[model samples]
Target: MSTSYDCSQPEPRREGLAAASGAVRAGQLVVFPTDTVYGIGCDAFSSEAVRALLAAKGRGASMPASVLVGSWHTIDGLVSSVPQAARDLIEAFWPGGLSLVLPHAPSLSWELGDTRGTVMLRMPLHPVALELLREVGPMAQSSANRSGSPPATSMEQARTQLGEAVPVYLDGGPSGDPVPSTIVDLTAVEPRILREGAVTAAQITEALGHDVPVAG
Candidate 1:
């Protein structure tokens, strides 16, 4: 069954953060809020938990999940390379809504969805998200809704969609951006837009370079 924890009280004290991370550490799923939308996440290293997350979404193995971290220092350990333009983008809009796809560490396990030598990484702007990630270290996270369904913008939506499958619902209220993050694949010869959500194509081109191909 699902448990709901409120995050209106702020970080650390917010029991939702603690409970969610606790669940993640134990290889269980927690539905939590992010800058863009709610996500059902688990410890990235836990292959079992990752499998469960995909199953919960009715997602296919070909669709990889993203990892959420608390800081830039944490990112280095997860990815193989963070290009200069990618770094510039992170410095500019991270802790906000932007997903950078970088080469994965050869040593990192890939059971967490498809991750095929690549990982979509983000440092959420919300206090609740950061607090949760800090406790869990890194989470294999994705939108808290079934695959092909509209992403949940609030805790209630997450609960409604996932129900008892999620161990805890970190209620951080509505997300700042109802849409998902703009996903840029830095692993490509030219940065490719896997998905365009919050960061506009114009904003990314200006930051990365005007020549970067805009995936329609």
Candidate 2:
């Protein structure tokens, strides 16, 4: 059976955090609210957990999953090198809805999917998510829904789709709008916008102090 917690309350929040942290460490999947939407996540270092996460969503490894962290400094250790534009963008939109795709440090021994030596990283602006992430380290996360379905905006919605595949659900209420984080590809010589969502192209340009190409 799966467990759900009402994170709006103090006692539940504490219990939920502990449960979710334990699940992640045990290479089990958990659902938590993010600034944009609810996400299904597992320990980033666990290939089995990541594979199960993708399988639960009826997804293939080609699409991969993004990694979420609790702090800005976490990127310094995950990626091979932090470019100036990455730092500027992080300072501007991190802890919000901006996902940056950067080259992963070659030494790390983890597989998210066919990431092509890269990983998309984000720091969500949600307390429950941040607390759990801080407690458990980086997590391989994707929107809490099956492929071709709408992303989950509430914990119940996530449970409806993911079911018992997710061992724990941290209910932080509705996750506001279902808009996803804007994805910016930082591996290129010039930054490129892969997907525009909560963040805008103009806002990204302003952050980098230069115009970036946006994929249509």
Candidate 3:
């Protein structure tokens, strides 16, 4: 059984985070909290690790996990032709609950399912997650739940669902917001909201200084 680390306690949390980060570097799955919800993830560059993430989530090949990075430079490396509006949105809402789908860099060796030559990226607003990214580089992550099930908002819930598939769990208590991140697609001519969650269309529009489209 995996020992859950309570993030409220500094010493244990640090020790657990180090162990979790180690598991990630070893190509093992780790369940951790994000600003919006709990996520299960593995090294994005490890095809073996990512396949394990998919398997743990009981997800199909067509459904891909998003990549999380620690900084804008990492996003820049994975993305190309970043729209000006994208830059504006990144400045305003990144390091929080916003996800951007941009043109995938052709050089990335690992696959994220059938991405259709595109990738969704997020810079989460959590110290633990950011530290993990800094330690392990980008990670391939999905909500810590089996496909078609409700996403877990607490460490206990995530543990129930992911079980031994995730060897380490970082218990950051309950995520303050149960809502998922807002997904914005910049590959289109006009930036579009593929899925709306915590971030609203009005907020995105204001960030872009223009009206953005919403996919129906």
Candidate 4:
């Protein structure tokens, strides 16, 4: 059976974090709140867990999930190198609504999908998510809804879509308007906006002190 927690209360928040952490470590899926929307997550380094997460969402390996970190420093270990523009962006919009896609360190033994030697990373600005991430290290996460469905903006919506597939649900209330994080691809010579959401292209250009192109 699956379990759900009302994270508004102190006791439940603590308990929920614990349960969510346990589930992730066990290679099980857990639903948690993020600044943009609810996300289904599991241990990032666990290939089995990653496969399960993709399967639960009815998604394929080609469209891989992104990894969520608890802090900015976590990026250093994940990627091969951090470009100056990436550092500027991380300083300007990290822990908020920006996702950076950079080349992963060749030494790391984890697989997210057909990432093509790259990984998308973000540090969400949510207490429950940050707390759980800090406890569980990095996690492979994606919007808490099946493929081609609307993203879940509340615990109920996530549960309704994911159902028993997710073992633990952390209820952090509604996510308000679903503005996803802006995605910046740092793999190329010049940074480009793969998808604009909560953060705008102008803002990213301002952050980098240059005009960054936005892909259609």
lDDT of each residue in 48-143, candidate 3, tens digit only = 998999999998769988999999878878976788878898899989899999988888787889899899999999988888889889999999
Model 4 Cα lDDT, one tens digit per residue, 72-189: 9999999999999999999999899999999999999997999999999999999999999999999999999999999999999999998999999999999999999999999989
| Residue lDDT tens for model 1, 111-210 | 7666667888899888888878887798999899988888999989888888888989988888865777888889966787778878888888888766
Whole-model lDDT per candidate: 0.84, 0.96, 0.90, 0.95
lDDT of prediction 2: 0.96
Stretches of candidate 1 exceeding 4 Å from the true structure: 10-13
The total number of steric clashes, by the backbone 3 Å criterion, in model 2 comes to 0
Per-residue lDDT of 1-216 in model 2, one digit per residue for the tens? 899999999999999999999999999999999999999999999999999999999999998999999999999999999999999999999899999999999999999999999999999999999999999999999999999999999999999999999999999998887898999999988899999999999999999888998998
**TM per model?**
0.93, 0.99, 0.97, 0.99
Model 3 score (lDDT): 0.90
lDDT for position 126 in model 3: 92
TM-score of model 2 vs. true structure: 0.99
Per-residue lDDT for 150 in model 3?
90
Using TM-score as the measure, name the better of candidate 1 and candidate 3: 3
